[model samples]
Target: MLRIRGTIGDLPVDLTLELDDGDWARLGSQLQPAPMADAPAAAVAPVKQRDDLWQSAQDLLRNAGQLSGLELLDQLEGLAGDASAAKRLLVRLRHSPKVNVASGGDTPLYSWISD
Candidate 1:
């Protein structure tokens, strides 16, 4: 048996799960690591800088399809290194014809507009 309790934003979450011996054995088999010879080497991630913020922002929306304004801003902040820069990126995205913004509850959702 396993138990978990956590919070997502203001919402509370509690969960309890029970597993029989057979279930545990099946799960253990699936969890086994692959042999090194069969595994592919991991590629290195490129370091992003402030100058790449524009392209990064575009790529983010392109891949995600849609993201809430707050979520977009949060990701921009990580790429831009500051809230101000993130705001600037937001404005650019708002003005770009390639992107569209729609109201989503408390925040707006930004989406890529494919032509």
Candidate 2:
């Protein structure tokens, strides 16, 4: 027996399914693991793009020398095309050895300190 209880678009839903031994055997057979295939090129492309974006972000900070958190976020958001992506890049920058983060009263100041 399988049971599911959830809400769909604010509507409550409950479902139950009962299966015999033969049915369960067939389902189990269908669920058997398949052989893994090589990863597709599309899957690898995003990683490269992310690396490029990271490099661009570093370059942006390097050129600017220093900027407030809000200011950096604005430029990164534009470069990344998403607020979440920008924030992620900001966090990555915070951890990078080439960048330094200092508290600037109301916001953090990001400065590029190349080694």
Candidate 3:
């Protein structure tokens, strides 16, 4: 069993994933580190083009396909600005147990185990 710590929705949780070495290897193959902005590039992120964080984040995240939870959040935070509302929205999205993934499937997405 491999225990990984990640943030899902709104709460912090420790996920104990039972995986054999082969399974772990397969998962490792699917994961990719996010591209980091170089020097002269701001690290915080940028405001998203769309107003709806849910829709925008979903599309970007899905397209980005295989990324660690931290990478996914880096992209999401890039879309959020310094607005108080935006911060609140991020909090809500991070902590929520279930989110609408827009596939007509209201599944539990985004686990925010990182406070």
Clashes of each: 0, 0, 14
Tens digits of per-residue lDDT for model 1 on 7-106? 9999999989999999999999999997866755442123244447688889988988989999999998888889998999999999999999999999
What's model 3's overall lDDT?
0.54
All candidates: TM-score: 0.54, 0.68, 0.29
Over 4 Å off in model 2, which ranges?
Answer: 1-37
Pick by lDDT: 1 or 2, better one = 2
Stretches of candidate 1 exceeding 4 Å from the true structure: 1-51
Candidate 3 lDDT trough over 10 residues, lowest sum: 99-108
Candidate 2 residue-wise lDDT at 41: 77
Give each model's whole-structure lDDT. 0.87, 0.95, 0.54
Worst 10 residues of 1 by lDDT: 42-51
Q: Please provide, for model 2 over 1-115, each residue's C-alpha lDDT reduced to its tens digit, 9 standing for 90 to 100.
A: 9999999999999999999999999999999875435667777899999999999999999999999999999999999999999999999999999999999999999999975
The TM-score ranking, best first, is 2, 1, 3
TM-score result, candidate 2: 0.68
Error of 1 at 19 (Å): 95
Off by over 4 Å in 3: 1-51, 82-115
What is the RMSD of candidate 1?
Answer: 16.1
Model 2 C-alpha lDDT versus the unseen true structure: 0.95
